[model samples]
Target: METGKRVPVKAALKSHCWIDANDYQSLYQQSLQDSVGFWRSQAQRIDWLREPQKIRDTRFHPDDVHIRWFYDGELNASSNCIDRHLAGNGDAVA
Candidate 1:
């Protein structure tokens, strides 16, 4: 059986960590309460070719259902996923 448990964050990695428990809850609430603002804030984390002027374009209805996010923005998957984070330490062991 697998035991579900949480581990304490060590000080050294805390600075590089993205969000702590409390911040995660706040982010989740922001996503629900203020979706567009949340998305706009998150979009800043990645490198964009053309920054998005509009946050979202979505319609949820039985007759017409459509959803488009960051339609105007452009980003490379490899850059966003791997290259951006490797800026300073390219030769370091993983």
Candidate 2:
């Protein structure tokens, strides 16, 4: 039997990362204006792609519940994270 109770993993992870309210707002504002540029920079840092194209457009509204993602180039998140490694020595752990 467990001796002590613990918080759920999701909640624990969320609490581990803390962002300032002001910083989040600032970043969100910038993203609204130039989301493509912002994500392009992130892609470069992670070396996710050899050449990343600029984002076509992005729009965010406080009242709207949906977010729009648009780009001229194509990339699959699962492929990037897994498929790329399959050619060499990539395998999932048991």
Q: Best-fitting candidate, measured by lDDT? A: 1
Ten contiguous residues minimizing lDDT sum, candidate 1:
1-10
lDDT of 1 at 48: 95
Clash pairs, candidate 2, are none
- lDDT scores of the candidates, listed in order: 0.89, 0.60
Candidate 2 lDDT, 1-94, residue by residue in tens: 4769764547667676666557779878877888777666556533243354644444466765554343444556787777767777555562
Candidate 2 scores a C-alpha RMSD against the true structure in Å of 8.9
Stretches > 4 Å off in candidate 1? 1-17
lDDT of 1 by residue, 35-86 (tens): 9999999999889989997889999999999999999888898988889778
Error of 1 at 80 (Å): 1.6
Model 1 alpha-carbon miss at residue 81, Å: 2.1
Q: Please estimate how well model 2 matches the true structure, expressed as its whole-model Cα lDDT.
A: 0.60
* TM-score of candidate 1 versus the correct structure, residues matched by position: 0.71
